[model samples]
Target: MTDTILEVRDLRTSFFTENFEVKAVDGVNFSVPKGKTLGVVGESGSGKSITSLSILRLIQNPGKVVGGQVLFKGEDLLEKSEAQMRKIRGNKISMIFQEPMTSLNPVYTVGQQIGEAFQIHEKLNKKESIKRSVRC
Candidate 1:
């Protein structure tokens, strides 16, 4: 095997309302090997974003991942606690929102935002993170 980095099996997500439920993502399945990328393409509102959100466990109120497993490096992310997920997110994995304008804080420089990741994930001091960000 080439070493599977991520595997999503029977992934499902839904939005619940008072009267009905919208199956945003239903039975999605795929795998990506290490050093590979998976591109999900579809029409707008075809569950692409929902699938990504569910994988990251970012689904909020009214939206739930009702089923399936998101395996990252052979571990089930769905079974991880919220605190665990917090560490995994931004460190092990992240979502780059489609909207660039709203994704970052305009007040801060791009380098500052980028360095924050290193600070949080790698436990680097602010000075070290800034240096690393500059090199990138």
Candidate 2:
């Protein structure tokens, strides 16, 4: 079996504004092998975050993945349907934003929010998810 866990080939993501287009990620490529890690370091606006977002298919509207493929365990994530992506996200593939607290809803407790993620990704009941979240 191959030790390659992820392979991003010629990924290109862009944003279309009314006046112009911004190519956040143009032909980016890399891979993460089993028992290995990869870190991206660059100046701000160098498409670091955008690359991660694209890999997860989380690019917001106005920004889209224009080309290339993200192979995770030999499956092309770019070709997966939204429903399929939903199942893979947070379960098989996960990401942590730079400032994660900003991603959380202030109205919800941190545990509760994490519990929701656990419930959605693991198909655990609310009570069980909440319990698991608390333990973490």
Candidate 3:
């Protein structure tokens, strides 16, 4: 069998609100093979964002990834250290938000922001980085 690139098994995420506990992701399970994509389609508040955030371990206080395993290339992502996950977050797996204006920093030039990606992952020098960033 082909190896699984990403596996999320029985994932559960919850938020402790002032009055009650809100279950954002309830026992969600899926696997994506290499070079494949999984589109999660749901209405707002259907746990789409929470599920993605949980995969990256970015869910903050009040909401937490309470259960399940996030395996990337057969490794348990939930068990990875923050530093390790930081390396993976953008390098191995990159996310582009729906709103580009908001995603980019107004203070920084577009080239600067894009160059940061190459700098972090590929360790490109400034001149070459800007060139590649512009191409991106």
Residue-wise C-alpha lDDT for candidate 1, range 26-103, written one tens digit per residue: 999999999988898999999999999999999998999999999999999999999999899888898888887998
**Leading candidate by TM-score:** 1
Whole-model lDDT, model 2:
0.91
**Candidates' C-alpha lDDT:** 0.93, 0.91, 0.89
Q: By TM-score, how accurate is candidate 1? A: 0.94
Q: Tell me the TM-score of each prediction against the true structure.
A: 0.94, 0.89, 0.88
Candidate 2 residue lDDT tens string, 1-136: 6799999999999999999989999999999998898988999999999999999999998999999999999999999999999999888887877786687788987778788878998788988988999887
Question: Number of the top candidate by lDDT?
Answer: 1
Arrange candidates, best lDDT first.
1, 2, 3
- lDDT (C-alpha) at residue 135 in model 2: 88
Angstrom error of the Cα, residue 2, model 2: value is 2.4
In the order shown, the candidates' Cα RMSDs to the true structure are 1.3, 1.7, 1.7
For candidate 3, the 10 contiguous residues with the lowest summed lDDT are 90-99
lDDT for 112 (candidate 3): 85
Cα lDDT for residue 47, candidate 2: 93
Residue 19 deviation, candidate 1, in Å?
A: 0.7
List where candidate 1 sits over 4 angstroms from the true fold.
Answer: none
